[model samples]
Target: MKKSLLMLNAILLLTAVSCKKSTEGGNTGIIKTDSSTTIVTDKNGKVDSLSESSTIVDVNGKKYEKTDFVYKATDGTLVKVIFKNDPKESTVAITSNKKTFTLPKVESKGGETVYKKDDMTARVKGDSLHLEQGNNIIELKRTKI
Candidate 1:
């Protein structure tokens, strides 16, 4: 009887050892059960610790959600802007009903010589002016008004 019991114990131990498996893939904590289903686990084998989802990325931040108006910088009746691309550091953006020009490195950050009415719907910068339209027509002038 003792010999039989010892042999049974040895067999059980071997079976358990053979059934155990070592996980690979550098501990991503994600296990694919099937083509349509997946299981995510944590360091301690707990599930649902962290979740991930798709998100929209905006490089210009929330400027599009503010308003639909053009920006320009001018002094009195004199326009400073003359052409686009002069201020290589400035970016021009537009929307359906408006446009926006962001100059992170302009004479004044928020200062713009705005125009919307008449045949002169234009933005005047220091020594340059940009025309606005449905597409991006923002330009940077190198001169000062």
Candidate 2:
């Protein structure tokens, strides 16, 4: 009887050990927040995080959303454009090569938005960015990243 009981216990122990849950490919080091923030890390302590916030601004007595766009020029230059629309006024900040230029919204009609500062004018239409400064015109394509 003792020998049979010992064999049964050994079999139960083996079954329990074999039925253990797997921890591979699970959310071991991922963090999320309510404000659309996500952080991912691996066992080696390398972390990658992204956070985006929803911003609403009132422009011309109407609500508009603040947005950002990144465009790449033909020469591989990157330009960052941030739009802040307020009920009273709208503006855009264009940054490239460590320089930033803030321009006021001069026109927004027919699916095209135009911002101007001094002799520089930027026009955004769909996924394309057109910049004009004096006699030079630079065209940029929108980047998804």
Candidate 3:
């Protein structure tokens, strides 16, 4: 009887710990994944857990995520960025020039999202998305609706 009680207590304790809220960086609904692990952020932008995902895609022996982000520009330009969430290789594709550009996560600074491939780079700053190549920087802002 004592052993059963101890086992029940342990299970309840584990459940309490796992259900705690996650607050990663004030950005929520972000899912990051790799081959063996997936990290999810809650709506308040907190880290939930390091686990695996049900929506996974195998690419180059790594797991890609189906969760993506889309932002529309005022000029009727639509930009889409696909995420895989790997620590080293996060981005799968970025939309530019009426074409889809495949890229990866480069240098991330100040908790902002940045993707790059060769000389092209795309960065997100709040509601503004910036794409840079050579000396030209194109800025796209989201229209408030």
- Give the top-scoring candidate (TM-score): 2
The residue ranges of model 2 lying beyond 4 angstroms of the native Cα positions read 1-54, 57-64
lDDT agreement with native, every candidate? 0.36, 0.67, 0.59
lDDT of 3 by residue, 93-114 (tens): 6654447787677767775778
lDDT of 3: 0.59
Which structure among the candidates has the greatest lDDT?
2
Q: How many backbone clashes does candidate 1 have?
A: 14
Off by over 4 Å in 1: 1-110, 118-120, 136-145
Residue pairs whose backbone atoms clash in candidate 3: 22-46, 23-46, 24-45, 24-46, 24-47, 27-45, 38-51
* Ranking, TM-score, top scorer first: 2, 3, 1
Candidate 2, pairs of clashing residues: 58-86, 58-87, 59-86, 59-87, 60-87
Tens-digit lDDT track of model 2 for 1-145 = 4554455447547976995544565552332212332243334556522112234533344565566666778986666677776667789888775578999999999879999999999998766889999999999876743
Q: At residue 88, what lDDT does model 2 achieve?
A: 71
Residue 145 shift from truth in candidate 2, angstroms:
2.7
Candidate achieving higher TM-score, 1 or 3: 3
TM-score of 3: 0.49
Off by over 4 Å in 3: 1-43, 46-54, 58-62, 96-98, 141-145
Model 1 C-alpha RMSD to native: 28.5
Give the true-structure RMSD of model 3: 17.5
